[model samples]
Target: MKPQVILFDLDDTLTESKQKVSDEMAQVFSRLLENNKAAIVSGAKFEQQLNQFINFLPKDSNLKNFFSFPQNATECMTFDGKIWAKEYSFSLSNEEITEITNALNKVLEETKIIENEISYGERIENRGAQITFSALGQEAPVSAKKTWDPDQIKRRDLQKRLEEIIPQYEIVIGGMTSIDITKKGINKTKAVNWLSEKLDLPVSSMLYIGDSLFPGGNDAIVIQTGIPVMETKNPKQTTGIIDSFLKENVV
Candidate 1:
């Protein structure tokens, strides 16, 4: 059956981590809005998604059919041709934000990982609804980020420690070198539920695509919704999948 809504992960699944969406992928993605309501559900903030992907889409693309779920779905926004309008946000309070960042700093200090490694920029970023810790720094080159935690061993360890320190928050590995933290139950699955309900589509009528659907990855939580899922290795594979979906379902 053809999906009524198609959701995507913004990083490696849609484009290279932190890289701008290429014209090829943007064209394919624009075609998706021709048939289905599409959304980019990612751990990055809206600004990141705007710069990386939305800005590359064709001017004729159907903006109303597109949704943005950034900060691991803690925030939702939709485009209106002129600007993005917020649908909702699970913003953190100042006290909660301070506590989370303090815990992150303590973990980094005790682990000595950040101290031993050569750093680039601010490692911890506050994204209103979520706090992200980039193990290699946010502005690090893709080559450096890719090599930092290919197998996710280091991040898993950090996650375990962070979980213990901040049990109230949700912690998961995201992108190539970042760990994302949001309120418990406000992960990607929340966005899935919201999008499904907002569109009046059942879980069976939606499809999710991501590189990190495996257990412990950031996108893993989405599988709990029981929506049909397709795993892609990279943006190239994602483009091919979109092309095939359109071809098979063409009217």
Candidate 2:
């Protein structure tokens, strides 16, 4: 049976990290919404989603059929034509945010990996319910970000240290050069389950596509939910995956 909804990871999977979605992907996305519901789940904040993908969607695309899971699924937004409204959002208290910040500082100080690295924009951002540590800065060029941690060795070590220091929070490697810290149990799987319940579809009727499904990758959590998954290397391959899906199932 065809999937009731298609869930996608934004960075790497749908487009280059922090890059706008291609015109080709936009057309394919609009076509996708013609027959099925679709959702974008990313570690990015809502504005990133807006600039990178949502803004490029076809004008006539059915807005109601789309969902946005930003901030590592800590927040969910749905389009209501005029604007995107919060379906739900989880927030951290001031004290919790402070603790997370302090923990990150302690980890960085102890690890000393990122301390000497040159950064781009803001490195640590508190996105309401989640705090992100973008190693090279959020606006760093994709080339720089890719080179920063190709083997994932650097980030995996960072994540391990973070987990030890901030055991209360869920920490995961995100995007190319970022670490996501969210409240416990809040990850990509949370978004997938929420969509399953809201759309009244079983996990078996859903498919998740992402670039990072390997162990410890941000998108890896969805694997625990028993949803079908496809791994794509980049946006070009993602377009091909969508095209094939449309051919096989859109009729």
Candidate 3:
């Protein structure tokens, strides 16, 4: 069945980790937006989303049909033809940020995983609504990020430790080398539910595609929303999925 809207996860599903959207992907994705409503939900900040994905799209693309749920959907942004506006945001308090960051630091010290590694940038970032810990640092190369945690064992271990330290916030593994934390109940599921109400469509009318749908993965939370999902391992697989969507007479 054709969906009223299609939702996507950004990092590995739509593009490489922390990389810009490809020309071919932008073309196909723009085509998809012409007739279908689409949304990108990621743990990335709004600036990263624009720099990595939104900036690559053709200017003529249908911005009205596109939505961005950055910071693990703790914030939502939509285009208003002339400008992108925030529909809603759930920002963290300064106290909450401090607590989360402190917990992250404690866990990192206990694990000592960073002792021998070369970090690219800030290891922990306060993204307003969400705090993210990128194991190899925020600006780590894609090759390094991919090779650092192919099995997610290291991140899962870290996530376990962080959860124990800060039990009030939501923590999940995302991308290749990042752990994202948000307020309890603030997640991709909330984003989809918000969009469903905004569009006056049922949750079942949307389709989600992502790379991390396994248990404990960030994308796994959306499964609770009962939206149909297609899992892809990488951007290439995601492109093929988009191609199939284009072949369908979806409107």
Backbone collisions counted per model: 0, 0, 0
lDDT of 2 by residue, 1-251 (tens): 56889999998889887889999999999999888899999999999899999989888999788999999899999988788799898898999999999988887888798877888998999899899998988778888887899888988888888788889898888887888898988888888999989988899999999998887677888998999999998899999998888998734
Clashing pairs in model 3, backbone N/Cα/C closer than 3 A: none
For candidate 1, which ten residues in a row score worst on lDDT?
113-122
Candidate 2 RMSD to the real structure: 1.3
Candidate 1 residue pairs that clash: none
Can you tell me which runs of candidate 2 are displaced by over 4 Å?
249-251
Off-target runs (Cα >4 Å) in candidate 1 are none
The local lDDT score (0 to 100) that residue 239 gets in candidate 1 is: 98
Query: Clash pairs of candidate 2?
Result: none
Q: Residue-wise lDDT of candidate 1 within 51-146, one digit each (tens)?
A: 999988998999899999999999999978788899999999999999999999998888887776766787999999999999878798988887
lDDT of 1: 0.89
On a 0 to 1 TM-score scale, where does candidate 1 land against the true structure? 0.96
TM-score of each: 0.96, 0.96, 0.95
Q: What is the lDDT of residue 241 in candidate 1?
A: 95
Off by over 4 Å in 3: none
Indicate the worst ten consecutive residues by lDDT in candidate 3: 242-251
Worst 10 residues of 2 by lDDT: 242-251
lDDT of each: 0.89, 0.89, 0.91
